[model samples]
Target: MAEEHEDPGVSLVTVDGIEGKLARVELPDGTLEDWRLASLPQGVKEGDVIRIDVRGGDVDVDHQETDRRHALGQRTLDGLNAQTPEGDLDL
Candidate 1:
């Protein structure tokens, strides 16, 4: 069997199709994190290299907790999009 891997950090990959100005970043562990950019920030584009930052905060691991966190993040992302004239899109 292959060895398991740990999440080193988050990694931002190239942005795919655009809609509301959101970009899909590839998480360190192969998951995707939709980053809502304010007017697609400078130097950010397709095939551009970027790093994903994870802040130190409380996180719940249980299913319910995971769902809660996910929802919270989604809400935060939505707020970010709302703040900008150009809405955020998902990948």
Candidate 2:
């Protein structure tokens, strides 16, 4: 007879913080785990919420949240650029 195994169902997690290329994630059960940021979808950042499919070992980004964050970041960058002195060329 073959043995049966249970699936590790998908989990909803939030990005708590990032250190280097690793992201500290808060699991659905309130536990924290570190996952490689490179393994996750592009543009994931701190405070972003994402869905992790354990069985498939895949991570999905929350598009709406990501888009919102992206917009906010662009605004901040624009503000910084506006404050820069022209012809500085300090790349």
Candidate 3:
């Protein structure tokens, strides 16, 4: 049998301050993680959940963008040379 448990991730973060569009969150591990909450109230303070998300790949913006671009580029080239959901495409 396998035990069920939440993966080690960010939680119970105390919000320090919101400078512009950034929310500085202090994690349960005593480290800080920055979050971006667009159009939401910055009222989260000193002790709050703030937000919850996958901490690893989701936080690597540059690497994520590069990966996405590479995937799309590969799909485009593949589609142009083969049959795809978009129908036969021209290169």
Candidate 4:
């Protein structure tokens, strides 16, 4: 029986960070992969969502998806911080 999993031909990853020529990406499985900056889209920055075509080795920035994910993250943060409060304590 084939195990259930996402499509292997395509993947969506977020730009985690960039180090020199290497770009760090967070995969859907929460694993990190290092890709050459040259392989990514021009002007790629942290938090940018990328769509990778594994078979064709094509990578592109998904602006719409990025915005969606960003909004989702902001909503999550806002929801989590809405209730429980804590005062800032300077150390």
Please give each candidate's TM-score.
0.35, 0.53, 0.35, 0.75
C-alpha lDDT (0 to 100) for residue 2 of candidate 2: 12
Model 2, residue 69: distance off in Å is: 12
How many Å off is the CA of 43 in candidate 1? 3.4
Candidate 1 local lDDT, 1-91, one digit each (tens)? 0111244443233343344667674443455567775434454554343433345332211244234545776898888888877778564
lDDT of 2 at 75: 78
Candidate 2 weakest ten by summed lDDT: 1-10
The prediction achieving the highest lDDT against the true structure is 4
Per-residue lDDT of candidate 2, residues 1-91 (tens digit)? 0111233566667788899999998776777889998877788878776866777877787666556756886777777777888722232
Predictions ranked by TM-score, top down?
4, 2, 3, 1
TM-score of 1: 0.35
C-alpha lDDT of residue 26 in model 2: 78
Candidate 3 lDDT tens digits, 1-91 = 0111255663234455577777776555677767774523344433333334456523222233334545776887886767666666665
lDDT of 3: 0.49
Judging by lDDT, tell me the better candidate of 2 and 4. Answer: 4
**How big is the positional error of residue 19 in model 2, measured in Å on the Cα after superposition?**
1.5
Over 65-91, each residue of candidate 4 has an lDDT whose tens digit, in order, gives: 888878987777677666556733222
By lDDT, is 2 or 3 better? 2
Rank all candidate structures by their lDDT, best first, as comma-separated numbers.
Answer: 4, 2, 3, 1
